[model samples]
Target: MLSFILRRLLSGVVLVVTISVIAFLLLYAGGGDIARRLLGEDASPATVAQKASELGLDQPLAVQFGTWASGVFQGDFGTSWFTSQPVSDAILSRLAVTLSLVLGATVLIAVVSVALGVLAATRRGWIDGLVQVVSLLGTAIPAFLIALGLVIVFAINLGWFKPTGFVQLTDSFSGWLSSITLPVIALSLGGIAGVSQQIRGSMLDALRQDYVRTLQSRGLNRRTVVMQHVLRNAAGPGLAVLGVHFVGLLGGAVIIEQIFAIPGMGQVAVTATSQGDIPLVMGLVIATAILVVILNLFVDLAQGWLNPKVRLS
Candidate 1:
């Protein structure tokens, strides 16, 4: 297990570095001089040259990347081209908001998917049909459309939640929850749909296994057998599906954040990419890569824990 974890960590580090280098190169190669963009297209060539020199944009790609890589190791992500603020600071400021949304949505997905999936697997008729219908709708609809509809119905019409803006947790826990509710729901629906379907399928297979029948024949109650034996075995594949859904959630958060005007890493990523803020864009890419790696690591560990047969190495 330790070796497995170490291997995963090393791979994650390598992945982050590779992604960072690729992002840097892409931004570097992308046309439109950074200095000119900063100074305005109308700026004189001499002014652009001076700005580029000052910003180290005049340096060779290798030297510039070396400097940026060194700074990354030292916890400095360089300064944003437009804001002139440290990239780390800018990202850190919005990290909490994005984390809140993602984490909240994850919790909701876990609870809803497991409950619905288990119920659907155990029950018959209308309940199973309803779960299937929900799964179909969730899989069929795009997150942004769901978000828009939710905003129109719940926020604009019912006034159940604030349509946009975020409140920090430190300020008011209730306010934070309230502010994040719609966004979380929007982000979670598709994840819930995917995870529940996987769970339902896995559970059905587990229930049909010989071990489940053996457990039942031994006088274990249906619920106990299903919960203790079936769910555990079913969770492995469900977990793997959840990991994939999580990556999707991250991508969806970008669109949801924009629609809701929430201040988050997603919003920052959009702005940085659109404005050609290379440092900030690089920071976002590396940060997202790290997050994805970490989440997958957790999913791996969970699967290994839930099923002793899963060989981590």
Candidate 2:
């Protein structure tokens, strides 16, 4: 198990490095006239040259990447070209908001999807039909549209939550929950639908296996057998689906944040990209890559735990 963990950690590090390098090239090399944009269109070529040189944009790609990566190792992500905020500060300050949304949605997806999946698989009647209907609706509707509907119904009509703007947890825990409720629901609906379907399918397959029949023949408690063995086997595929949904939640937050006026990594990412803030963009990319790696690592560990026979090496 220790070796398994170590191997996953090593692979995660390599993945982060590879993503950072690719993102660096895509943003720095392909991104045009960043210094000029910062200095404004009217700035003289000499002034732009001075700014580029100062920012080390004039250096060869290898040298620039080396310097940036070195600084990153020391916890310096440089300053935003436009805002002049430390890139790390800009990202970290907003990271919490995005994490809150994604994490909340993830929990909702896991609990609700699993329950619905299990019910549909076991009951195989109206319950199954209901799950299918919900899955269809969730898959059919766009998240943004759902978000808008939620705002209209829950926020505007019922006044259940604030339609836009985020509340910090430090300010008021209840308020924080209230602010995130609609957005989390919007983000999780599709995930729940997809994951529940996958879970139902996997569980049905597990139930039909020879072991399930053997357990029944041995007069084992049906609930125990299904919960302990069948569900365990089914959970592997469900977990894989959940891991993917987590990433989707992160991407979906971009629109959700914009619609709801929440300050998060998504909002920062959009602003940084539009303004051609390479340092901030690079920082966001690295941060996202690291987050993805960590999430995958957790998923791998969970997978290994659920199925000991899974070969980590």
Model 1: weakest 10-residue lDDT segment is: 304-313
Report the C-alpha lDDT of model 1 over 113-156, residue by residue, as the tens digit. Answer: 99999999999579999999999999899999999999999999
lDDT of 2 by residue, 33-125 (tens): 878888999999999999999999899999999999999999999998888899999999999999999999999999999999999999999
Clashes of each: 0, 0
Residue 41's lDDT within candidate 1 is: 82
RMSD, one per candidate, in order = 1.3, 1.1
